[model samples]
Target: MQAIAERSPLLSKYETFERGLPSHPESIKHLRRQGKDSFEANGLPTTRQEEWRKTNVAAIGRTSFERVSQDTNSLSHEQIRSFLLPDCIDLVFINGRFSHKHSQLEDLPKDIFAGSLANALVQKPELVEAHLGQYADLGHPFVALNSAFIEDGAFIHVPSGVTVEKTIHVLFLATARDGTPTVSYPRNLFVAEESSQVTVVESYGGFRDDRYFTCPVTEIVGLANSVIDHYRLGQESLGAFHVATQKVYLSRDANFFTHSINHGGALVRNDIQALLDAEGIHCTLNGLYLARGSQHVDHQMRVDHAKPNCHSYELFKGILEDRARAVFNGRIYVHQDAQKTDAKQSNRNLLLSKGALVYSNPQLEIFADDVRCTHGSTTGHLDDEAIFYLRSRGIGEEAARSLLTYSFAGEVLDEIRLEAVRKEFEEFLFTRLPKGDIVRQAV
Candidate 1:
């Protein structure tokens, strides 16, 4: 076939995906039908859509990007050498397709299930059908599009009363091949049944500076008495565009901790929705993003309380530099029937340059008068006094700025439960940080 084809009224991108999809002819047909219906219903989320009023994906929709290239990835061999953890279950994907060669999975507890979404479809259709697309509505064009055309996605099932001994890491690499504008929609579905515990880590990889598009959709189901810890790292090509949406459903006494760190990408927009559908469920949302040099980072989150005695806490902090822009929209919805629900939301930003920008909106729509719900949003620069204090203590100006910058993002490091992963991330994060306003260096 041709390298790239003009927009088609029939098939998306090409006849097939980046790589051949997993074995799921029936599910694929089902998804294609639903996807076409959704696309027809909602062409795309325009500026008119209140949820996307601040950030627009019209540019993505207007262009018919080329399909992913089939060339072998350079990240194959050296990845494990530089890879941080050895005692973890890892799944490696290059150009959006799973590679069996580089992955490592050992000592996983009997209860944890990890594999390609394509594999999950063929092996565990019942699990996939029972909980897919249940929490998030199909209003947004991208999400609906994802649900409609989902070929294969990551699947993790933690059985009841089993705490997985090791963390499962998913690494996705997208590279610029043949100068064609490529795209990857990596999907993930997680199921934590009653009294089960699991942790999932998603790490973004590929080139350092190349223009690409990564649109991913993730679904998480938290059953009764289950605990799940999720860490999503966005360190893609600096010129790439990332649009990801995650919808979570929480049952009775379930606990969830989700942390997102975005340090790369030209335009990044993430939407996370958490639904507390049963009593005594608790979830925490924590995030950090460093935007620089005309980059844009946006985060939209919603914590929904539809049942009684559920609690949710959300905090998002960002650092912007050199004309970078960041936005936060946090909404907590408490239905009238959700009595005694407790929800708290906060968004704070730190602007390091005169041209840097931040837009924040934390909203609470509480239909229950007896519930406790509070939401707040703040935007400001780093504390000058704190920087001055550090400089006064015989610290160089550059070192002081670095200290303050790292400290501004230091809160997120606390929430990471894994010491090895957190330490490695800190090191990488520090190396990528700009010098900032610090002009002097002290011996």
Candidate 2:
């Protein structure tokens, strides 16, 4: 592994990053060192590996992305207002560092602790140490890299028996500085205690045409009887690269729901894993991705039913056009003790052009005899009959195509519990489609 570490271009950057770090508790320092060692041992994944065969990340390993500083920049509230949600508390982070000026956290509840993870480390190190680096897999290179550079991000803790009425929005914005391609590692931890309820929104975006890299890892823990609703919106710049991982842990009788929507990024990959650690857990995972003009998007999902009497469902849809490509790999694993487990996984894709490509794979691994598991995948072009039907009903060809595309992507959007977030994405979709004005008017 020392040989591999010597060959990596990021080795020097890691050295620089380590030397500049502030002193911390032995636990965190040990975790960072462990991550550095793990990353050096495994290195960045390549297409030669089965897990990354469909997606190539050679460019990421070849590029040099400088780490961003925590100093406040010139970004203003008005510039990021569009990404803010109504009737919610917003915590803003610029290049992975929390910005108190742009954040609207005044309305945060008294019982809830929603703020920067770095702040939490200083003020409440015990709480931060309990859950940090506990759930996400360290074997993965990206996760290890994020762990090695995990300085700041959102940290939300909901105490027992408390319900947050308003949504908690955490926004991460990336901007290029001095023409230097930058990279940020945003690590977030959301812990919902027993019988508590909360809704969290994680949004990532950047300036259009900016070249950068964003590697983020989020861990969500739902205790017994807790309810957690999460939404992750990825709208990075078209020229940027994004690799993210999300790990979810559900206890007995806990309910966890998540929606992942991706609309931008030159190269994007999302890795999600959910663990049903106890009985009577209900988990739902939904995702939507739109790609066009040579963009590449990939989603790798796994649901592990480790206990009995657990239910999990996954549905992911993608739309590709103009030489765009997408990959969806979803798997369900039911352990030997997980009897009476019910799990379903589905992946569907629509190709709007002949050059567009999609690779869909849905798998199920069940060790329990009495478990019920099903998986399916479908990929094809738009329905000619449906388009013709709309065209015959007085809609133009472009408008008809736009309407069908909108309808195809609407399935996952409808699953969003936040009305404001749903509408914002709808408007974004309207602007992205051809003859969007006509479709918006007709709808």
Model 1 worst lDDT window (10 residues): 434-443
Per-residue accuracy of model 1 over 1-443 as CA lDDT, tens digit each? 64543333323743455245555656455665666577666666777778878777777775556555444345658754464355678887766667677677666666567877767778778777777666656666777666665765578898889888788888777776666667777778889999999888887765767777777888899999999998888887887888889899999999999898888888898999999989999999889988999898989998889999998998888988999989898989999989999898888888889999888989899898789888888888778898899889877666677777777677777778877668776776566654532321321
Per-residue CA lDDT of model 2 for 150-187, tens digit only, reads 88999999999999998999999998787888889999
* Best lDDT among the predictions, by candidate number: 2
**lDDT per model vs. reference:** 0.78, 0.90
Query: Candidate 1, after superposition: displacement of residue 189 in Å?
Result: 0.6
Model 2 compared with the native: what TM-score?
A: 0.97
Clash pairs, candidate 1, are 35-148, 117-153
Q: Candidate 2: misplaced stretches above 4 Å?
A: 1-7
The alpha-carbon root-mean-square deviation between model 1 and the true structure, to one decimal in Å, is: 4.3
Best-fitting candidate, scored by TM-score = 2
Report the error of model 1 at residue 106, Å: 2.6
